[model samples]
Target chain A: MRVLGVDPGLTRCGVGVVEGVAGRPLTMLGVGVVRTPADADIGHRLVAIERGLEEWLDTHRPELVAVERVFSQHNVRTVMGTAQASAVAMLCAARRGIPVALHTPSEVKAAVTGSGRADKAQVGAMVTRLLRLAAPPRPADAADALALAICHIWRAPAQNRLQRAVAAQHAQNAPKGRTA
Target chain B: MRVLGVDPGLTRCGVGVVEGVAGRPLTMLGVGVVRTPADADIGHRLVAIERGLEEWLDTHRPELVAVERVFSQHNVRTVMGTAQASAVAMLCAARRGIPVALHTPSEVKAAVTGSGRADKAQVGAMVTRLLRLAAPPRPADAADALALAICHIWRAPAQNRLQRAVAAQHAQNAPKGRTA
Candidate 1:
């Protein structure tokens, strides 16, 4: 499966694309940051972000988009901007019929670095090792985006298994020939 | 000027359109809520908001859009949703080339009533009075949206004066005839 991960922010939105499945090697399709001027009006900033994301979506056309789930416990100002940016990212994907998945920062870190509490450098190092890149992606946001994609790709199998088990349980609970 | 006011929210996005100048009695073109099911996914909710806002814009073609400014000091979860919804509202306006304005809750309340800390009922009462309606708009959110449009209309003259004053000051300070 191909996935595009977004580390959403107003000033610099990090985007990365990875193609592969669980229990197999992954390929880094692309990585970049969409930067908007801090001095621009919020409306214009959102429009710019939308255009940038649309370009990424058109070029990569990933089957799924993974966005870093925003939490309110962070710095209040930063959290609002992040939430706004993520909304634009999700809107762009959903408008085009692409599925969007949200994974928390801790989830991304834990998926790649073996611990949710892993530091930035640790996550970067592991992403580099997993992707077999000579150097880690620059601007921690970029590396974080890659880590998010890797996490989504790796976690899909377990999530599917859990979903199937739940479905099977529901099916067993129902009477036969109830299907309409 | 015609203004479309948006009180952004996840479940019920309140919207109102008002037309007229500050000194003149304003006309209420429309007032309603754009609702998305609370159980809907965030992306789908945002998309729904976008569609709703676009329809309002298409119908009214307001010269300006007045949206409530989101602050992070409020309930974290609610604030995040508000911010996301506001982003979509602003995006719709900006994408259509309509000027976007943000009014804080305090500012809107103050503009409608005499106090910045006016309660919902007070604001609703004032909105009803100003619009010359027999009854206040139902749903506090709807009233609040009308109040926002009213606030922007009332504040525009003062804002324009301030802008002109600043521009004159700059022109005086600027080097003469560098127009080449």
Candidate 2:
């Protein structure tokens, strides 16, 4: 299964594509950051993010998009930007009928480093070793993105069942003849 | 000028359209809520919001879009959803080349009523008076959306100048040959 992981941020959204399934060697397809001007208005910044993400989606065309689930407990100022950027990432994938999955930061770290509280360097080192790259991807965000994809690939079996149940419940509870 | 105001939320996104300038009597073009099922996934919810906002834009053809500025200091769980929804609202407007403006809750309150700390009922009453409506819009979120439109109309003169200066600064500082 091919997966596109997104470590969402307004200033530097990290995106990486990984191809493979659980219990198998994964190939690192690509990794990069989508940057938006800090001085730009939120609307313009969001537009920029959409365009950048579209370019990535056009190039990679991954089957699933995994984004870091944002939590409100982070830095108050940055958390809002994170949430907004994540929304754009998810929207782009969903619009294309690509399944979107959300994984927590700790989950990503644990999947790659065997510890939820692993430092950036450890996670980077582990990602480099796992992907058999000459060096870890530049910018911690890029490494985090790869970690998210790895986490999703390993956890997909369980996550898929949970997602299916949730979708079924939602469909059952939906109002009659209401579009949403 | 006609302004489409959006009070972003995950479950019930309030939208209102108001027409007219600062000193003139305003017209309430429309007011309604765009709701997404609580159990729906984030990507689907965002897609629903985009569709709903697009329909409003198509019907009203508002010159400008006004959305509430979400702050992370609010209810921790709810603030992230608000930010995500607000991002989708801004994206819809920006993609169509319509200028988008953000108004804080306090700013909307102060523009309509005498005080920034005015309660929802007070703002709703003033919105009814300003738009010459028979009754205040139901659902505080709907009233808040109308208040946002009214606020933008009243503050546009000053806000436009500020926005222009900010835009100019951003343009000046932008990297050469760099697209954002």
Candidate 3:
């Protein structure tokens, strides 16, 4: 699957495209950052983000996307922005019929560093080592984004997704289903 | 100063471009809505929003942006998306050397409807009437965005903005500057 990993932020969203064969090597397609100025108004900022992503999407054509699922508690304002950015990312993938996967910070950290509690620096270090790159991914955010994709790779089940869904539904509605 | 106002959201973000003339009308240059899928990941959703905004920005470049400062209770996920979308919008405008103006929801509402307690429907009605359009702006969210632009126009005095800033700073720092 060709996976695009994204670190969504209003001002700066990091994007990384990685393609992997079922049993072969995973290759890095491309990596870059979409940045917006601090003084731009909300409308313009969002537009800039769209434009940047469009440029990347045109070039990468990722078949799937992995984005970090936010569970942050920083405050209302901060959380609001994070969620909006996430929503925007999801929308882009959905419109293109590109399947999307979301990974928590802990999941990414664990996948990259073998520890769920790993910090950004540690995760970055591990990402660089695993990818065997010439340099560590700059702007910590970008590295985390790549790690998120790695986590999704490890987590995505091959053929049991539907089975789990039915099982969960059966468990939740067993009593109600009997009544109906 | 020309200003673009944005009402950021995942499903739809409202964008209104307005140009301020010294004594002429507040020219409504353009208005549109950027849409994203509701079920998409936040990252892809953001990409869609960016694409929509980019088209508008390329068509009409406003010099300043006015966005409603977000405030919400409950629904952390929703709030997070809004905030991130708002940030992206801000970055886009700022990158083009546009100054950003943030107005509180109450401030925008009061300026548009002369009442801080005005509901969304009331604000939408006033905006439709104020713009003197053939019909009410569809997708209340878009009208809400125009209202934000109108609010900025009404709140920003015609006098030199720089001088006003200095005087306002003085008033805050020097209590003696207050007339009362």
Candidate 4:
């Protein structure tokens, strides 16, 4: 199974993809970050995010996408940005009909490091160890994204089966006529 | 003199313009957030930011631009992205040969309120009250941008002096080789 994970942000978004077989060590696929101007208008940044995800998706064609599920926001601006970023990721996956899954920050952290409150450094270290990388991912966000992917690769079921199950659940419970 | 403040991001960016004088309580020339797709390409997003800022600058013809300065980051990924975003803002201002000022988040918060430790909501409330608006800027980042503009206006010298200063400073700090 191949899995792609993303750490969403308005300016800098980290992305990582991993491939492996069930009950076997996962292999590295690809990783990078999509960036936009923090001082540019929001519309511009959104396009950057969309294009970044599209480039990665087109290049990798991973079977699944694992993203950080957006939560509540005290900063409406930050929250809105996060939501928009999430949408872009979803749209990228939807375009190819690829399956997408979301995990909370805590869940990914817990799965990777045995603790939900692990710091970025700790998470980076763990992600490096899990992926058996020669070095830890350079940026904390990139490390976090790698860890999220590892978390899913170690937990997500095999390709068609896992995606189908989640899709069914989401469809059954999805609100009627409400936009994604 | 109306001033437009921009807090740029890849997803949702904050933009606010203030008109009138500093002590006299400026008019809220305008305020809004631009939304971008999260998964969009970073390059496209940057273009969007540039276009949007250019359009706003043309429409408002604000006397000055105030942008947030990014601090150092251990994650080169985020740092690089932020740097790129900030550069776009500077470029937009420079293209118009309009004077641009930058402030750190702390400085912006401090200038808006009495405390640099002020949170987003506090700053938003203060900006709204400072302008005597009907509501707080829904997105705190936009309010913060406006606050930054207001702060710059409050700190800038009189119109005659500012115009003279821009002329003298223009020689040494011109837009050439601005991207570092």
Task: Choose the strongest candidate by TM-score.
Answer: 2
Candidate number of the best DockQ: 2
Q: Using Cα atoms with residue i matched to residue i, what is each candidate's TM-score against the true structure? A: 0.88, 0.90, 0.62, 0.48
Can you tell me which runs of candidate 4 are displaced by over 4 Å? A73-75, A158-160, A164-180, B1-180
lDDT of 4 by residue, B44-132 (tens): 45555655676778788877778777554334345434544555565556545566677778888888888989998999898989999
lDDT of each: 0.85, 0.86, 0.68, 0.70
For model 1, residues A15-64, the per-residue Cα lDDT tens digits are 99999999999999999899999987787788888888989988998877
User: Each candidate's DockQ score against the native complex?
Assistant: 0.28, 0.45, 0.16, 0.04
Cα lDDT tens digits, model 2, B1-180, are: 789999999899999999998899999999999999999778888888888888999899887889999988878889989999999999877666567898999999999998999999999999999998999998989999999999998998677556556645544654312121
Point out the higher-scoring one by DockQ: 1 or 3.
1
Indicate the docking level reached by candidate 4.
Answer: incorrect
Return the lDDT, model 4, position B136: 94
Question: What DockQ results for candidate 3?
Answer: 0.16
Q: Which CAPRI level is candidate 2?
A: acceptable
lDDT of 1: 0.85
Tens-place lDDT per residue, model 3, A145-164, is 77776666666757225433
Off by over 4 Å in 1: A158-180, B158-180
Model 1, residue B86: displacement in angstroms?
0.4
- Per-residue lDDT over A1-180 for candidate 2, one digit per residue giving the tens place of the 0 to 100 score: 788999999999999999987888999999999999998778878888888888888898887889999999879879989999999999887666567899999999999999999999999999999999999999999999998998999988677556556545544654312122
Q: Is the docking of candidate 1 incorrect, acceptable, medium or high quality?
A: acceptable
